[model samples]
Target: MEFRVLGPVGVWNRGAEVPLDGAKQRTVLAALLLSGGRALPDSRLCELLWGEHPPATYPAQIYNYVSRLRKYLGPDVDIRRQWSGYMIHPGDGRLDLAEFERLATLGREAQENHRYEEAADAFHAALALWRGPALMNVTEFLARAETHRLAEMRMAVLERRVETDLLLGRYAQLVPELTRLVGEYPLHEKLRCQLMTALFRTERQADALAVYHEGRRVLAEELGVEPGPTLAATFRAILTAEPARTGGPSVVASSWHAVRPAMLPPAIGDFTGRAAELSALAEVLTGDHACAAQVTGMAGIGKTALALFAAHRDRDRFPDGQLYADLGGNRGNAVEPQEVLGWFLRSLGNAEPSIPRGLDERVRLYRSHLAGRRMLVVLDDAADDAQVRPLLPGEAGCRVLVTSRVSLSDLPGAAVVEVGTLGTAEAVDLLAAVVGKRRVANEPAAARRIVRLCGWLSLGIRVAGSRLVARPHWSLAYFAERLADEQYRLDELRLGTLDVRARLDGSYLALASQSQLALRRLALLEVPHFASWATAAVLGVPRRTGDEVTENLVDARMLEVTGTDGGRRQRHRFHDLVRVFAREKADHVDRMAVAASRVLTTAN
Candidate 1:
């Protein structure tokens, strides 16, 4: 049996091509094959099939597709369940995609060893494996998502093979093919450079200069940028009658000229705790793991701090450099994706004049720059998935760490990591790191009381420690005594820029008016945990509405779920600090209204 995904997704049994069910089924097969034997979750398959609006019965539909696929594949293919997802073991089956990669790697290694002829042959073999556009017969969404990278890879191989051919002086032989490639990929500066070199060596100096000018014209008209250094150098050599040097990978990748951006902010000095989160994120993000991770938690839960620490912890993994952007999601003045992309393009070595005027153009150009680079993009305080999506690198070899106060599950290929408040010891350790370990050790009881009073929130604890740092005379017991006042706990948890009130205020104000009212009424009850029925009664809405509203608050990171009751009714609670803040809002705004509702309920 043979599985092919380089062009049209196909399953060939014996000598005949086996017909699959449909485009959707082919999409499933293509996804599994591209996964490199790793299990692709059912949810991902559903997304590829129906996009954002998959049918509620998508699980059964996907299962049926897999079942029918088994019948078509016979007993050769091993498509078995793996955890909650499905996996396919190809056994000894041949896959063109795998073969292509193996040959491509051989070509790259040979080229690096200066074996020009061997490199060209290996690259030619790899290129021969591609029949047509990859995954063309799959679903549209899958085709779009997966094909661009494959096409880029093909173009790269062709470019390198051209380089090796030039080194071997196959000048006249390369002219026709190089000309066609230059025509096909007009904006590809490396191809233009190669074509110019080919024409020059073939005694067509005038034609070589013409190719250069033509590229310049197209670049200015289409992309609004001058030819890059490598292309310009080729034209210079042609005009000056000097030999155009065709160097190795370094020279060919000259068109990929952009400054490697070391844009990650300095790690927080007192970055403490989150061992578990750091490990989980590293598995998905650090080193060669190409993935996007959303560190989600309430405001003041230290999402940004965690992301920065994680990125810095493995900073060397991405030798290409790092890119950081603060979308200001929590500040409520979210930066536009277009603007961030523009900044990123400029940072990645793009000249000001070279950046495209529009968002889509910039996205393509940006992805082109990041195609084969190992870089870490740290997006801090993202507003939502949409705001962060455009900033994401469209290729592998780049990892993204996004810190947001809301769930960003919809962000393509993102692993959402929920960062709750610090545990008691972690909170105390954070305070110790902020202040001094000796002081925390001297007053262990006060440290515990202070962290508990601050609700074990990272920001709250840091601010409380910062307050102590500001007043040298203040003792731990005195600070804990100050935080004990419910009305002024938020007031005390503010020093310089660190303010728990301001941090929590953003999440609170972001809520809809009805949700705002629901949260406030819930705060009026003041119980640690309450059932959905309590929410419905307090909000004067149906149980379903109350469940939805409560869920919204949970998603917003304003509420917490404290296990279900004996009857299996889910109960919700607020962070200690949020409870105080919510109750304070109720006191200032809706205390009397909730009191009236309570009186009416008693009367009934």
Candidate 2:
């Protein structure tokens, strides 16, 4: 027997549709389904079904309905009569509404913990169950009200799903759907806000802003009210081009001339693959809410490249200005929070002398300056929590984009996005994107070898691509040959000027000695995924100490806590580049020792 309530309430028993005798009976069944096995009072049901009007034999009528439903439901169904009212046990029957709620709740929980991919899956599952309006056959006023409630819930779930996708950076893919949704729900302020955000992320700043204006006009003409604070703030963001907070400069500015698209440095080529990654990013930005997305990976995995691609795509969204800063958290001269704030204030046109000296004072002034303007700030290579915090705008009108090898969980309400290696196909495309397609096609096998040798690191691919671009006479086969020599592969890949090693070194130098050692030890594990206990075993330290070390690594972007599954198992993994670095740092003997120990400890 299948009882579906996600659309019209229906029961399929023994291959036939069980006729629900009257509107009241259907209403009773729906009410029971909504409550999900919980008892609802007769009075409440009466109020819901008949409102102020009650039939002369209301009690008798309800009893008769329950009796008839029981006959159809058969022995498997449990219809219990309680003092308050009644309860229906759906048993093993498929109830769409019940499943929908369950999946929605699960998705929400996953999102809260930063498991975006999983959350998207859960939400999609929930949404798929909805065939159409809930209880479409029923005409009772109470049924109509319930139907409306379910419809609203469906929208909310869809919005959440979109939000998860955006956080994953799936902006481009979501644009079409969001456009339609925005039109369908023209008066819904929240939906409008999401549409604007998605449009902005896709580099359609003008369109995003247009959506806000259209929403304002619709609201005024129909409801006689201005846009609410959320919508208003988003509109202001559109006007100023506030960067969504990923953490860097709220805007990027160039002196001497206006910055044009052509002026930006070309991202590393041979960018073989990251379609999934890019799609995930678009999804979060277009999803139905503002999110703080964190892009983290090991040094030289192209975290910056991916972030830059996303920024460029959405650059038009932040018209107030685009800000970029290297926080120096990973290596080199760490850019202090105060220093970044000062630079940001100056970029906003605050003169050096006018920029506040005190940290708190500067933060206040910075936020005050950005109060009503929409700006986009990119804090690249963030060093630590303190370095990024003061730079965040206080108003909701701005967007910040932050990129780090470390995880910045300390940054409250920020969404964390982890970047991994490019897939084989993306690697090939990236190479093609950078080096001419003709050259790659001429030596497809050699090109594949180069990609694998580069470990599909964006930085490595770019360096390899740059080499190919600069040396026109060199064949792809030659580059592959050089990478094949393990002893000098890293050195060979290290072009004197643009070196991925140097970039990674900067972040490594910033770490404390113990943390660095812990990172090295982590390289010993063969398993791609791990937990605190597994990490602890590798470090030869207590679980708490291991946790602290792992946390430090996470902050530094050397590792990411993917999520907890089942019970106590908290999954963690290093970005492919980081893993490569760890392996490079470990000699064969040390690596073997660590791996063996981890295995034994985990087994016990």
Best by lDDT: 1
Q: What is the lDDT of residue 127 in candidate 1?
A: 94
| Root-mean-square deviation of candidate 2 | 19.2
Candidate lDDT scores, in order, read: 0.80, 0.70
TM values, all candidates: 0.73, 0.51
Range of the 10 consecutive residues with the lowest summed lDDT in candidate 2: 248-257
Lowest lDDT 10-residue stretch of candidate 1: 247-256
**Clashing residue pair totals per candidate (backbone < 3 A):** 2, 73
So what's the TM-score on candidate 2?
0.51
Off by over 4 Å in 1: 1-181, 194-208, 237-260, 281-286, 317-320, 348-354, 368-374, 414-416, 532-537, 564-571, 587-604
lDDT of 2 by residue, 349-414 (tens): 555655557776666556545544556667788766557767777534456667877655345345
